[model samples]
Target: MEIFTTVWKDWTMYQKSSLLLMGICIFIILISCIYIITRNRRLIIHAIASILCSAIFTVGTMVILHVVFDERISYIYMLIPLVVFLVDIISLSMNLGYYTSTRNKKSFSPISVKKELLRDSLQLSIFIILLFSAISVFMGGALFTFVIAMGATALLIPWTNYLLLYWIYR
Candidate 1:
């Protein structure tokens, strides 16, 4: 633990943030895949949507605050996502237990108006994140690249959500 902590402390701001963000994504994808195993996706899909919102908001705020001020991002940015990842893992485990405990008793309710919006919003955010990630990978996380990626992510989230919501529901 000490060695790992020391190594983490030595990493640059970009490296630390990138590692945390990647961890966030990998955990989210894992949770989503686990969610897919259920016979009904109503709860999981909506849950994914809310999770995505929280993920983007925390990361976006961290990134934007850094970009706008040219300062270091607080660890609060990374910690929130880490906490979410931990929660998701626990939820996934419980979900699996619930699924197996009683085949006749399913907990997920039918999709409602709220669930529909959550699912749609999550889907859109994923698309936007992918588009940005592709661009970032191509450019590489060099100097200024992190800022660009974060800035773009922060700026595009609302636009994407609004556009998708209008296009899909309106």
Candidate 2:
């Protein structure tokens, strides 16, 4: 209990620069994951570009929040980009699954709309969880607690994708 309290105090003392550095590291890791998943050169280039754009947008928003609104840099700010990255991952997974199942052919089936809607809803749910996690973290929740919440939220992506694929096949 004493050790945990010490760790929490250290975490609370982390500076804005440290948070920014961590965010940059996560962005790099995300781009690397994209490259590994999609080996096509053009796709890798596009994915890196997209990730860079997202990083810029997030940093810009944080700057505005800090300067204009006087918001402090915290774990909550990190959640914004994390959620955005998760949504992108879910969307990419769904698109890849759809294309693989359809063999790159145009879908003329009536169920396509349903599949798309499900994918969209899954993305929305991810966003909502992101919002919730951010709020919880900002409220001085334990780091492990917020991590558990994120992990639980992440489970939905695979489950939603699996169910969607099963329905599409059936």
Candidate 3:
């Protein structure tokens, strides 16, 4: 689209690399989440948490960046990735809670290596997000909007999986 082309022209190589990394990270995180969500049809908390956290993270990050840094990127550009990164973190947090809950133990399948796997996955995802934020800060906030775009991507991927599949099929 014209908008994407214009935005693409405006970003630097570092900013673009950051965006690509963020996109890859979001895709991996969302894929894992979609798998879990499909497997555990009884629980919808992960999906809900991802949505709420996406909104909160987007607004919070935007306000904080505005106050702490002096970058002038479009709101749309910044919003795309912030939502993505936040949703993954949120989804992982909910997953951690669910896996550790008493309810999990009561299920027919006892707690096993799956819990460990989930915990590790969540930790890795969180670490990546922290890395993105830290690196963006060190880069003088120029790529901060791309980082936000990553978060936004994280938010959309899981929820739109069905829509994506439908589009592909149609």
Candidate 4:
């Protein structure tokens, strides 16, 4: 039909990728829910929640900025959710490593891994907020700059958390 053709032609690469990413996120969420139910792993539930929230927020914000405010959304915004998702996967692997490491030790408890992750994530989040604020101030202090800083924060915190955990655990 003519409508299908028009829609197909008008579709941008970003839209295509966004749709794909959303599909992947949905699949992950469903699988994670099943996994949580079967294994009673509450930690994974937190990762699932983070992935869902960050992906939704990133995509929704991009839509609003583009459609409502007529702002030029960058393709880099697409990377945020993907990066967050990847970090979650890596964190899980790292946690598994930590568990094995603790098992081999005489005194270290597995619970310490969760505590360390939570502490590092909180510290990284605080650092990102302060850093973003400082950087945004120097970048002209506009509303748009603030929005950009927030997006960057959403992208940075999980990534930095993963790196810090890797450094400490490895």
Candidate 5:
């Protein structure tokens, strides 16, 4: 019980910049997911670029946290980003698989492709949200910071969708 308390206390002490970076990462993931669902080639490219940038930022933030704050790394702290990375990889793999599977099929419908993409997006979103919730539960650092993190995680979905649609149609 005491150990749990200590760990929670430590987790809550995240720096403001670290929290902001994490939020940006989540935003990137959400945008990628939205683009995947839409199947817009141009938008997908932009989202991928954003994802790469965010990944770089996230790694830099992690390094700063480790060196400057002297914080010990833990799997719990990395869970959400790892899951987001996995989801991106999985989505790419699925796209390749779909292309290969349909190579010989003459009657491939755009509707089917859209459906599958939507399904994948929904699954990724659910997993991301669950990961965020789990992380929040074990977070012991700063309560206000945690709340900001939670807000960012929660807002990512709708904000990404809205921005993607607005940009794509504009």
Candidate 6:
């Protein structure tokens, strides 16, 4: 209880505002996703992807904040909703495009989609991790910055996979 109080007192305006902003964006995205899903029952896969990605983001944020206990954690949190929404929108658009392009096809096989998603996600995650590592080492050159960059990159993997899966199958 005392520790919680101290932590709360130490919290800055940035952290509070970041949390509020994240919550608002998440609410909007959630509503939009639900609307899209309801309109097109075929997009059930999207609902699953969004839910899984959201869970991963939420858990990663909580764990990182707990481990670091730093004010700068809010900086990472602030970017979460923006990244999630951007990926969501892009993937949704791609899914729509794919659907229209293949309207004549009876159905997309889940097995092929899964294989492609896994391979693409692994490739993308590796690229992202390496890119962040290089940027942190070359630009920041600080252990702290490296750790933060790596953490952010780690948090991004699930969302990337979500994006790929949605794009691949809709």
Count clashing pairs, candidate 5. 6
TM-score of each: 0.36, 0.42, 0.38, 0.49, 0.41, 0.52
Best model number under TM-score:
6
Residue lDDT tens for model 3, 51-156: 4555555555555555556444465555554546554556455544544454445462323324443454555557656766676675545565667546444534
Best by lDDT: 4
lDDT of each: 0.50, 0.54, 0.51, 0.56, 0.52, 0.55
Q: What is the lDDT of residue 119 in candidate 4?
A: 62
Candidate 2 vs candidate 6: the TM-score winner is 6
Candidate 6: where are CA atoms >4 Å away?
A: 1-38, 42-45, 48-52, 55-59, 68-77, 84-100, 139-170
* Candidate 4 vs candidate 5, lDDT winner: 4
lDDT of 2 at 24: 81
lDDT-superior candidate, 5 or 6? 6
Regions of model 2 farther than 4 Å from truth: 1-42, 104-170
Q: Which digits, one per residue and each the tens of the lDDT, describe model 1 over residues 52-139?
A: 7646665565555556755454443345455544443443344345444544555433223324434544655575566656666666
RMSD to the hidden true structure, all candidates? 12.9, 10.8, 10.9, 8.3, 11.4, 5.6
RMSD of 6: 5.6
Clashing residue pairs for model 6: none
Error of 4 at 133 (Å): 2.4
- List candidate 4 stretches off by more than 4 Å: 1-9, 12-46, 60-76, 82-97, 104-110, 141-170
Question: Candidate 2's residue-wise lDDT over 1-170, tens digit each?
Answer: 33335446776555656766886887688667656665545434544554555455555555665566555556654586676556546654555444446644576343673466466656666766676666666555344444444444444444444354445455
Candidate ordering by lDDT (highest first): 4, 6, 2, 5, 3, 1
What's model 6's TM-score? Answer: 0.52
Candidate 2, after superposition: displacement of residue 117 in Å? 9.7
How far does residue 16 in candidate 4 sit from its true spot (Å)? 1.4
lDDT winner between candidates 2 and 5: 2
Show pairs that collide, candidate 4: none
